[model samples]
Target chain A: MKVMRETIVSTARELFRSKGYAGASMNDLADAVGLKKSSLYVRFPNKEALVPAVLDLTLQETFGQRDSASGQWDDEFVEVIEFIATTLTDRGRCVGLHLAYGTSDETPIAKHAVRAFFQAHRDHLSSILSRAMPVDVARDIATDTLARLEGATAFVAIFGEKDAMKRAVRLSIEEAKNAAAAKSLSSR
Target chain B: MKVMRETIVSTARELFRSKGYAGASMNDLADAVGLKKSSLYVRFPNKEALVPAVLDLTLQETFGQRDSASGQWDDEFVEVIEFIATTLTDRGRCVGLHLAYGTSDETPIAKHAVRAFFQAHRDHLSSILSRAMPVDVARDIATDTLARLEGATAFVAIFGEKDAMKRAVRLSIEEAKNAAAAKSLSSR
Candidate 1:
């Protein structure tokens, strides 16, 4: 069923995020979900085929975690702050981005999937930032803010200092509000 | 000689930065400097050792690349903007941070070189940011700005577009300058 496929992909994604692509084995993935590697092949032709699916799940999980929370919560400040915290606070996600971002798409194996996953996210972020500022500038802020979160999260993961990461999130909120305040003032 | 080791590390760092950690193989590293991988290993025990040393080269090169055209070079704004640009604009330097930040010291194989590499920079950033801002707040801005640069650069790397990357860089410059301006107004 489609639900089972989703579960399988999600499990594989957790494994990949914890372990680097080169470090993660198919057998390990099979063992995690109680399904044989053979059974997985029906859903995923190979580990290579499964990688993109897993990455998609990871990105979706990341987005959903924020989108779901941000949807009901009407506070713009909390929405942006929590969205950043969710992305940066996790050890697994930080390491995962480094592994994923640093890879090249020279092989069909890595290319299209990487393109799809990031472009979709960028488009989504563009939407969020656009609400706060002009289209191009908002998109730029979204890209810049996301980049800071990604790199800073990696540092926090290694350093294990939530304070540093927290400081960063606060700084972002201030910048957004400050910029907005400055804009409102200029207009007035 | 120390000079030879420096040359090897510098060349390898540039290659690794542009080509990426995995994509830049030992053989290609050798080819870059017209040396054999074996000869290269004389200065560097292996990739593990080379990465740290290469990262040092990257930091040095980054600081060195800062324009010294003006005697006003030490101004906090100038220093931070250029430093942010080096980390954000260049794919290799971003990878240097990626590799360093993602690397764990749980094993002896894990190099702790990031401390020396990032500390001076972080400290330098804070020291400069504090010049015209609150100490605690300046520290936050420093981390936020650095993290933003890292994040924005990664986005550019993934998307590989000129306008987006350029806009991110421009915003980054503006954002830092704005923060400094905000800090100045608060002090007054």
Candidate 2:
């Protein structure tokens, strides 16, 4: 049952990514999931309830693997960004981010979900960056890093150029390193 | 007549920003523009056609003013980003870019419209940055700058924090300046 629920959420997430909340239909989700619309509703109640479930699953499935590695912080940082880029290029799994940005002004649920996700992601990134720089500076770099990566992901989605996002991520990492170096130099 | 068309497009753009393309109904647009749905179609045939027209008007209205001022490239560059951040925070006037990212995958019209906007913006930015650095480096910075600004715009939309976007823009401009300085030093 757990596996079945995960499958349903993952499939819904994919549909949401490509078709958007307003564009994606529950009937299609039912068709894709190999269930009748009635059965799907038995599991999810309605589209409104289903979206948050899908987002939670996305958080777990997409970012859950972020903590498994034991490499150096720099390697981990790059790997984390690479994972996000890979997701954006591979399946446009960042659809929740898109929905959040698109309709959060009118939808409190989406606003909360996306804001929590971004804040959590920023906090995780800041913790890693703080090891090499001041906490305040690290927090700023983390915010900047998330903004660049997220923006690059959107650009790739719009333009279909993988390299554009890759270059942006690389430059952001480089800039953060440079800022850290400059901060250290000034301190000395 | 031309002024009326511009007013309609600008008003539709605002509706699209706060509401996603799928979420922004034709009725809502009609109401926002103080026109009946039938009259709105007389102007735009359909919502699909209306979006691209709105995007073109947005390009002319937003980025059109980019070249009117004669100032140092650095100041102009920062000013452009500030302008963008201002738009995102001020009135949420960046709905076209949002549409491009959100619907471009399934809609060819959206893909083309957004691609053209991003490409043209990058080219314009490249022209400005080229004055300060090598063309190749300037182009890279231009792309990076666009990605950052676009991403920061989305960030502000999602999180509703104006300062986060503002700080990201400032940092990106600073990093670009530093990159130019480093390139010059290497050449010297």
Candidate 3:
């Protein structure tokens, strides 16, 4: 029964990633899971109830072990971009982006969950950059870098332009390196 | 009759912007426009057909005369960021982004329309940057800048942090200025 619940949540995550919050109906979830509507309701009660579980699974899968042991800021930053690029180029679109755009005025729970996820992502990036620059500069660069990444993911998702995503990643890493270099020079 | 048709398209655009592509059903649009489902179908034939008209209206409203006669690249760039920032912060979310993310694999027409809109937006930004720097550098910067704008807009839309959007715009403009200055120095 526990395994079944896990499977259901993971499947629902995929559905949400592909169809978005509003687009993914409970009936669709039931159909995807090969369960009767009543059985699906028995498990999740309602669509909104499943959001936390789905988000928990997403947080685990995407953001697990993000810290780098090597402590190389540039390498860490590139890894972040590569992870985003892979998600965008691959079949699975950015789940957070889809949820961010798909959650309407009606779904406050989903909205809050999505917001928390993005905030955490931004904070993580900021922490990674802080190792190389001042806290404020790192925060700003992290915010800007995350925005560029999210934007590039949107472009890739919308346009199916993998090359554009690649270019954005390359440019983002180069910009980070330049910023770091400039900071070092100023300090010297 | 034509005015009513235009009104329906505009209202549908709003619906699409808010509810998303898949989330906005024909019944909902019919109700929003105060028309029967049959009547709505009489005009659009189907939801897919509405994608083009909806996108056409969006293109006209958002991208119209994006070209600046002032010929000052920095001001024009800031204008672009301001436009995006305003859209994200305002009640009306970025329609293109909603369409881009809300569109599922089933909705090819919606997908194409979204792709075209983003491509045109990128091209316009690139053209603006091209005037002040090397074509390749300008193109890269334009792409990066657009990605940042889109990402920042997403952040504002999801998190409702207007200040972050403002900071992103300020940073983007400063970066553009720095890039322009660097180009002038290199050329000399």
TM-score of each: 0.76, 0.89, 0.85
Candidate 1 residue runs with Cα over 4 Å from true position: A1-8, A22-42, A63-77, A80-84, A128-133, A171-188, B1-4, B18-25, B64-76, B83-93, B106-110, B162-188
Cα distance off (Å), candidate 2, residue B66: 4.4
lDDT of 1 by residue, B73-167 (tens): 23645555665575566543465565554345542343367655666566666676566566776666566556656666666666665454454
lDDT of 3 by residue, A36-117 (tens): 6678777776787777788778777666867555668888888876886786678537777778778766888887888888
lDDT of 3: 0.76
| Predicted candidate 3 versus true structure: per-residue lDDT over B1-188, tens digit per residue | 33398888989888888778888888898888777778987777789878778878866766686665566887788887687667667853677777777776687777788778877777877777777888887776776666776777776778666665776677678767888899899999
Better candidate number, 1 or 3, judged by lDDT: 3
Please rank every candidate by DockQ, starting with the best.
3, 2, 1
Candidate 2 lDDT by residue in tens digits, A51-108: 6777777677656877743677677777777777778877643675666745454566
lDDT of each: 0.61, 0.74, 0.76
Residue pairs with colliding backbones in model 2 are none
Against the true structure, whose DockQ is highest? 3
List the DockQ of the predictions in order: 0.36, 0.56, 0.62
